[model samples]
Target: MPTARIYQRPKNAMQSGKARTDRWQLEYEPAEPQRPDPLTGWAGSGDTRGQIRLGFPTMEAAVAYAEREGVAYTVVPAPTKTLKLQSYADNFK
Candidate 1:
């Protein structure tokens, strides 16, 4: 049986904007460990399912799709966001 994980997309660390972070993503767990190719010396795996990522607008939709497809999935809760509220003037202090 193929195992999958459903989770909310996290904000990219490269940018401050949170675009597309509201969506949930479904990804399959790797069936086998990756190995370095003998000729190219590049890490590769025979399981192509690891490259597949399905996105849904909501967590419920992602879960529904997993159930409908008979895919065993686990929901990974999104991390909580915390903001340190500070004013520009505080820097002077």
Candidate 2:
């Protein structure tokens, strides 16, 4: 039988060949430096060193702020966003 053409050769023939593609990638994603957060995997213990505290009349208020800020901060990927945003005002009684 006549030898098969190079392109039609079976893969088991042990021939080395290069591939060509008509398709091309459009946009290339930017390369970013990925590093784990230093404070990640933190175990919430009773340690307040170098940390800020929230002061509210009721424990519920503090808890609510904590939960809201935590969720919003993560949901929004803006450098200007922060969970420590505070509102303070004094009203004369």
Best of the candidates, TM-score: 1
Quote the positional error of residue 49 for candidate 1 in Å.
0.3
Task: Compose the digit string of candidate 1's lDDT tens values, residues 5-90.
Answer: 99999899999999999999999999999999999999999999999999999999999999999999999999999999999999
| Candidate 2 structure quality by residue, lDDT tens digits, 1-93 | 111111111122355442321111111122333445568954344323214422344334434554555422111111242366555653333
Task: Single out the weakest 10-residue window by summed lDDT for candidate 1.
Answer: 1-10
Relative to the unseen true structure, what is the C-alpha lDDT of residue 85 in candidate 1, on a scale of 0 to 100? 100
Q: What is the Cα-based lDDT of residue 91 in candidate 1? A: 100
Q: State TM-scores per candidate.
A: 0.96, 0.22
Candidate 2, clashing residue pairs? none
Off by over 4 Å in 1: none
Q: Candidate 2 — which residues are off by over 4 angstroms?
A: 1-49, 71-93
All candidates' lDDT scores?
Answer: 0.97, 0.30
